[model samples]
Target chain A: MTGVIVTTINLTAIYALVALGISLTWSGLGFLNLSTGAMYAGAAYGAWLVATNISSNVVVVLLGGVIVGAALGALICLTVFLPLDGKPNWELRTLTATLALSFVGTNIYLWQFGPQFKQFDPLFDFIREFRIGETLVQPSKTGTVIATGILIAIILAFISYSRIGLGVRALTQSVEGAALVGINRRTTAFAILGVSGAFIGLAAVLLGQIYFVEPNSGYSPMIKGLIVALLGGLGSLRGAVIAAFLVAFAEAVTLQYLGGSWVLITLFVLIAVVLIIRPRGIAGVLEGTRA
Target chain B: MPRGREDLLHYAGLAALFVLALAVPFAFGTLSILGSMGVFLLLLSWSISWRRQGGDTLAGVRDRSAWLFWGMAGVIAILIPIIAGTSYFLAVMVTFLIYLSWNVMWGLVLGTAGLQSFATVAVAGISAYVAGYLSVELGKSGNLACVGGGERILGVPVFQWWVAIPVAVLVGLIVGFIISLPAIRLRGIYFALLTIGLVELARAYVVQDKCNFGGGQGLYGASSFIPESIAGDLAGYQLAYVAAAGLAALALIIYWRVNYGRLGLLLRTARESEPVAEVLGTDIVRARLWVFLISSAVLGGAGGFYIAYYGSISPSFFNFSTVLFLFSMIMIGGINSPRGILVGTMLLMYVDKRFVDVDPPEARYVFIGLLLFVVTIVARDGLISIPDQIRRRRGVQGRGTNPEGDPPEDVGAIEQEAHMPPGSRPEPS
Candidate 1:
């Protein structure tokens, strides 16, 4: 049970990181971009690209993901929407176009690198065991999850309260209104996409450490991140975090009881059911925040 | 010729070239590369017209020009292979006629209803798997050969192909309806995403379980529709061309019926603004259901023809690339125009095949990437609508309007500078 819980927490932390980026894109950008996987894959590929240079520093590996992800995110948004400017169909077009680009990115990477799975470092070295009653269990990944979860919370809170945060909120509500207030829409949008992209890139690096990285690697988890964003309601950061844990835990438990292959099947089913039952997601849209 | 008249003449001349296209098998005198193209053009015409029929006010006999053009072209296509003695092309052309019927149905749903679907791929895939499995088990042998390769599905008796098409369509409709039940709740990205889930599920169930091996190498010759030796050979080309032509014609008519028909326009209203359409008293749910079912039935029929054309079907071909590419074909052609879309596929495939010639198979990615880049830059509205876009820009005609109002409409207005998702506010409370 403890082992399962630890795995759940670990996976949830990764989901939280990925979902936060997805939430930002959905809530802030008015996009349902499913290309987070491409960004995440970029990081893993970045690490693989410079594996000899970076060696094994966990921070370095993640930074590789972050920098590449942010760059790609900015590139995608600017390139995708600029051409589609003013078209009310921008949202759907953006989603479809981005998806195509993502495929291109994935295939490009695959063609250049060739198809192979690479193993990265696992953060934890030792597993510790403890028992409450008669049940025996070992807890691994406890530290990684705890430490990262705290960092994400702090960073998110800081953004929420800061002056820059205020400007971001304005843009989210109304680009014209923000411009009316002299928030500099162009600079601000660029800044936000860049920062948000990099942040998710870091999340991808963290995920790569736990799972095997390949072209299709980020897709399964990216789907989860999108679900968490939707389930938690668009733009709800806390909701995404919580939903991440819920999904991760449910998935881990399901895998523990049923088998490994069933985890994805379960998540897909879960999202379908949840979305049908609650279209607005579990978090509900924030009233105070700019929609 | 006057420039405008010349342009119309070019269209008419190209439109009239269906006679030449039909005669292709005979002209080429071989089931070589050109004959293969003949087969492809016919199937593409199916989906292309369905897309064209979208957002139109008329659907039936009233919208006769496009239908008439398609029919004339299709008849011309049929005669070419017959005159050229290209039985292979004729046979392939025959299968595509069946495909055209199905693809038009999908186009009606997709073009008319405001739905972004990926499940149609899965629906067709499932149909193919079913037909293949039944055909193979019943006694068909040669299942591993790639398309156009000189191979035959030896064991299965020929009669089954006759039964497979309708069965495949029925299965497609049933699946489409089932998917829409949950699918209706999803809007925008969520609905498209759900289809991906279904696709993966199909892959896992069909391919991995090996009951169908539905996940991996799709299906091999389950039924003996045509012999490969004759189809791939020079003499076989005419047969394939004629068959492809007939199917294209049949599909054009059905698609025209739905798209230019009353139901298709109702679908258009729903897609353009479902809520507004509902406010205006259109049964939004019913429209969604109707269009989706139409698409599935069409897709299923296509799937049956799909088996006949390829002599095999595999899950690998049905993966994300297939979905993305087909969607790209739709976008590159123009969302609601069938004529443009079919033409788009021909252009894209031709360009794609060119890349295959120049690059190592793996490096073909670079060419497609570059081509996609160019297309996105030059034809953001797709190739078919380029003139319309230019006219709109020049104010010669101000027809295509952006539905969403807030953001700047001209993509050119936004600078090519990297930025956040515009919504990435710090205080996304």
Candidate 2:
């Protein structure tokens, strides 16, 4: 039972980190950003390269992931968003374009890194494991959960209180209204992309410690983030965080009882049911307003 | 010019195009790339010239030209096997025709009806599995002898290629109808996501059902559709090519009928604005459902043909990448035009086939991605509109002769005219 709880919490933390980024971009910028998964994979590879080739320092590796993630985020913004700005069907165009980028990004990784899965041994070796009531636990998992909690809290506080966050909120509410109020759409959009990318990078580094990083590793997490974002309501940060935990718990319990394959089947079925019942998602508002 | 002379010129142009198309394979020899390019260029030039000769608003003339184009293209397709005279070249043609059929079906639902369905591969997979399972089951029965003097109707052989095709198509229509039931409630991206879910569920079901569906390793050795006498020869390719071309031609006709017919206009209107269509008393739900059903049946039939042509069915072939490829093909070709769909499929499939042989496999995705990106940004209507874009640009630069290049006070007039019926002038109030 304790193992299940720990796993659920750890998974929830990771999903929260990724889902937060997806929510921010979707709600704030009206961009689905399907390449978030690619960003995650890219960051994992970036951190892995740093740890394996340069130094085994955790900070350096994480810094590499952040830099890569930010760079990719900026690149997507410039190429997809900037070029097609002010178009009639900008949202759908960007969505498809990002999807294309996601495909290309995964293939690029496969071409450059070969097909073999790589591990971040340095990070794994550094983390210490402890036992609690006959259950063995890795501090790294607990550390990740705690760190994610802190980061999410910081993000929540920033979004709630900061000036830039206010600008993002305004933009999310209404693009025209935001423009009328003199908010710089370009700067806010870029900032959101940067911050979301960094969050994905951080999540990637932590996830790489637990799983093997490969060309296709980003696909599942991308799907998960998409489901969580939609379930939580696009652009709803609070709903995203809560939905992450809910999904993580369901996944953990399903894995514990049914087996591995049933986990995805059950999760997807659950999402379908939820979508049928609530098309706007758990916290989604009516059509006009962004969550 | 007189009407007779104008009509003569049109027929002459079409005849020249047909002759050029027939000569392409012979001129280029066994290399399919050059042959494909020559044919594509010939078609492109023909279409461009046809568009430039735009004075014929008479529906009869338009219909005749359309038929002429298709008829000549059909003749050229039939001549490909004889002119190319190689199994490799014929195989490439077969692949192009199959993709052409697939994309046209996709264009019906996605392009004309404006539904963002990603379940083309899933529907195809379902049909393929049905065909494969039936073939295998019937083949097994055909190998068995009846015991104890009992008539064994259940154990009788029914795995003929001809039998499998109709049964698979029927199964496809039923499955298509069933899937579209729930899909009618969903809209846009939500509907797209639902299809994705359906695909995942189908894949998982196929992968897990080891007893009936052959699980992951996949069932093999289904009897080939090609006859035993010419199974390994160029005749087999020719047979497959003919079947594929026939299917593609049928799909194109359906697409054309839908686009030009009343049902197509209703679907398009629904796509543009569902609320407005609803206000006009159009059965939006029924229209979407019918289009979905037709598209699904077409996709399912294509899948059946694929299994027949390839002699096997597997889950991996119908995965996410397949969906992406189909989606990108429609986008690249111009979703609105059947001709664009054909051009897009041929262009991308040719490039992809060559890349598989020459370049690193990963480069294909990058190339496709770049194409999608460039096409989405540069030619929103796809490569089909590129000629018009070029014309507009040249006109803008040269003499500003085209009013479309820079409409000063005509914006409001254009907007107002868009809502009015064609050939109906506004009342002078």
Candidate 3:
């Protein structure tokens, strides 16, 4: 039971980070950055590279993932979002383009990294495991959960209170109106994507501790993030966060009771039921604003 | 008078093309080095010299040469298996036809219906598994290789190859209806994402369910239209190839009837503005559901053919990479254009089979991805629109002085309108 709780909290943290990234990009840029998975994979590989070559200090490893993830995000923004923005069928085109870019990104990673799964040196070696009542808790997982909470709190605070956040909100409300007020859509897009990429990058590092980092590792996280973002509503950060927790709890419990194979089936059924009930999702924003 | 002369000329040209196609099987006999080179050069020249307009080119030739083109294509498709004859290329052509059939239906879902449901392969794969299970494993004539140990399932009738196709169709319809549920409610990317999740769900279920789905090892020895005694022979592959060609032709017909038919018109109007389409009493959702169901049923049948041809299937069929490959084919082909779909599938297959035979083996995916990325970025509508883009570019540069360029007057107007957002453009009056 404790294991399930720990797993759920850890998964919630990772899913929230990725879901927030997707939600932020969709609302801010009106682009469903499908390469979010590629960014996640790239970030994990980046952190792995750092742990192997440089010191495995937790901060240094995470910074590597964040930096690489942000770079990939910026690359996508320039390559896919920037080039295809304002084009005819912008939504569909960008969606397809980003998906194509992900294929490219994943293959490039596979080409460069080979197909071997890599394990990171335990980053939380200094922290020791402890017990709460009869439950034995591993320190790395606890550390991951707490660190993710702090990082997400910081990201959420920045998005909620910062000047750039204001720009993103305005742009999400109306592109033309925001542009009319001298808000640069390009800059806002870059910033949002970059930050979201960093968020998922950190997620990659954290999750990588639990799972093997491979060329294809990003896909599951990407799919999970997409589901959470859609369930919470495309642009609703709060809804995404809430949806992340709900999904994580469901997944962990399914894994605990129904076994891992049935997890996705149950999750899909749950998502379909929810979607049928709430067409716009829990807090579906940008309903009338977008086509 | 002149009309008779024109018709005579058209008949003469078509006859010459037919003769050329008939001679191809005997002429090349195999996909040799020199033969492939010659074919490459011929196709390059043909594409370059083809009409330069966008969809209008097809519309322009619709009355005159459209039938001629399709007829010629049909002849070549029939000849391909004979041309490849027992060579490894025959297998490639068979797979190509199957993918062509699959992509045509997927194009309907993506381009015509404007829904990005990514569960196409899942629908096909699930149908194949179910059909293969029912017909091969539990049928009255069960194979010894199956888990049933040749014992027929209780109360089940003889499910031979004939029953497999219809069983697949029924399964495809059920799966299609289920996937379309969210599509009816959710719009755009949400439906796409949900379908993506559903694909993962399917993969997980198949991989985990060992008894029924055969887990990762996959079920083998599927019932084929060809007799079991000769299934391993060259004749079996040839027959399968012909059947596959027939299937591709059937899918093409479906694509035509749905896209050019009344449902396509209503869907297009709905695609533009659903509220407006609703106001016009279009029953847009019903139209979408019908298209989705039709395409899904055909794809399910194709899936049945897939297992029949390959004799087995595994969970890999439901993998996201397969979805990527299929989507790339659609992207590289101009979406909704049958000609583009054919061109795209052939080009990708050529590259997949011939070019980029590199170490690590997985590098081919990189090539495919790059091809897709480049096409998506540059062509936007896939490789089909490249000729138009070139003509528009030349018209801009030469101001109609260039002999090959289209008229410059409306080219500029078309370019301007093309670049503008559809909503911002003046409503067509």
Candidate 4:
């Protein structure tokens, strides 16, 4: 049905946004950035505060979330990444630092906002949806899909063509080589993490309109993002996009057929089966990306 | 100092600490106060031997020393409940022991095998759930069939505290095997991420299925060491402490056997370099799988003890917070050091118990989080490695040579080398 299709696309867009954030950071910075979840929650709260106090305009709300998310990302970069960059076990150490960051961030949110769920007012009331074959599509979801598509396209283009993106690509390929080319690793890392954090923020804002935001809101999405990133292979952008759709489809189908609780269970089973068949994930098989 | 004098000093310090631990009950005489003193004594003893890595190479001395340390610690652990004379303190110690055992097994996977897996909690959680369900069901039906108050399964009583331990081990092995299926194909972050997802899966499945998994309240009325007739009495507390201490001893033995045994050597080789290990004819995957299975069994036993200790199992056992707490404990302890893990567990447990009275409970987590963040940045190997770092700084001893021309054999160095992307490693200038 059109309703299910719309939902699936919406879920896919959100997952892609999160997955792209994870994938980009891992490739560019050699850090897993598990704190993405905290960033997502922080961004959602930012968007919520903006919508509640300032303006409910879509662009304003989105920017509010993106800026807060980017700031938090940069915060993590400053606190965790910069000090530990190039250190021994940078990957695992950064991962632990990020995990610790999330723990701190989540608790801060809990302390400040309390544990109650906050709902977002409709941000896409101007949009209209058309019915197809007795199934009515949701306008909010339609807006999310279109908005996320444009944002992802813009991010991909930025990563591929922009000067900073070039440096990030170089860093991803080889840190020493990028250094030799005079790329400021610290500034470049900030840019990379900030952009990815913005991506997660945007996803959180888009999803906020659909779901309530809370302190622990980002944990599930972070898990979903990790699933997509893992199945797509850690650093492969194209693979992440493809895996996003795959995971979203599986999640949507399971949610529809088995109920909401079964979504994660089904997706995990899917990842397990897929990863068993191709250990490196779909991207590892298709693009031969490093695991 | 001469070697003989150094050895004498170590024993003298350990003996003095044993006396201190023995004196803890009389000095503080209360739950929190007494527990704090006991923890401090344990830390002091651990720190004394922490820098003596040289002694670790001498198997006989190390074994005898470890036995003396653990044996004394075990005695103190057993006596704490009786001396405290409060069921409340016993309950806290029991929980601490469970987490200690659980974290130790997790250390095996993360430290020894060098796989950053998070399914340790999930394995233990599953074991707890299964053991609890089995005990409840078997106790109800088997009691009727046997015409006795207690039922026996494999010569272990269905409702007994120790019964869950073995059952949990079996469940853990099965779950560990299943989880390790995809583990063979994946390595490093990919595998770690997968394990995290698995934890989420287990949590969601348990939470969503209210009918089967008891919804949010979780499964209850499972058998424990404490009898219903005297569940609130001092005897019940003593029994629980003794059972937990026994489980902790078993876990320590398992950790020692696997970590010091040939499997640990094989894993060290595989962790150093997979291709080289393959060239040397070591089945890296099988070795990891074996490690995973053994650790999982230990985790399962811990989980089994959890149900018996608490008389219930909940979805929160598989929570993200639980994972963070356990991970922080291991990381703080020096993920690779068992003795450090004990230190980490004791420190974190004390901090957690100490902060239980703080208002706006989130502050406690923030404090713990800040502690973890600071430690991760400041000490690469955790609190346990600080002494070594200090010694190195003062030029007491120089860095050891790596005969294989590899990076320094520190925890992070090896993990970094093992997981680095092919071109990402800096070329020799």
Best by TM-score: 4
Task: List ranges where model 2 is wrong by over 4 Å.
Answer: A122-128, A157-162, B1-72, B141-156, B388-429
The DockQ ranking, best first, is: 4, 2, 3, 1
The TM-score of candidate 4 is: 0.88
Query: How would you order the candidates by lDDT, starting with the best?
Result: 4, 3, 2, 1
The TM-scores of chain A alone, one per candidate, are: 0.86, 0.93, 0.95, 0.95
What is the TM-score of each predicted model, taking all chains together?
0.80, 0.87, 0.87, 0.88
- Candidate 3 vs 4: which has more lDDT: 4
Find the number of clashing residue pairs for candidate 2: 0
Deviation in Å, model 1, residue B329 alpha carbon: 1.6
Clashing pairs in 3: none
lDDT of 1 by residue, A117-229 (tens): 87765544444655745544434355456546655765567568977767777776676788799996555555566666766776666666667778878787787888777
Compare the candidates by DockQ and give the number of the best one. Answer: 4
Candidate 3 at residue B204, lDDT?
88
DockQ scores for all predicted structures: 0.28, 0.49, 0.47, 0.57
Put down candidate 4 lDDT per residue, B213-235, tens digits, no spaces: 66677777677767778787878
Deviating ranges (above 4 Å) for candidate 1: A122-140, A143-147, A173-180, A286-291, B1-106, B137-159, B212-218, B227-241, B373-380, B396-429
- Interface RMSD of candidate 4? 2.8
DockQ category of candidate 3:
acceptable
Error of 4 at B149 (Å): 15
**TM-score of the second chain in each model?**
0.70, 0.79, 0.78, 0.80
Q: Lowest summed-lDDT stretch of 10 residues in model 4 chain A? A: A282-291
Each prediction's whole-model lDDT (CA): 0.62, 0.73, 0.77, 0.78
How many pairs of residues collide in each model? Answer: 65, 0, 0, 0
lDDT of 1 by residue, B262-307 (tens): 5555556456555544554556677677667767777776777677
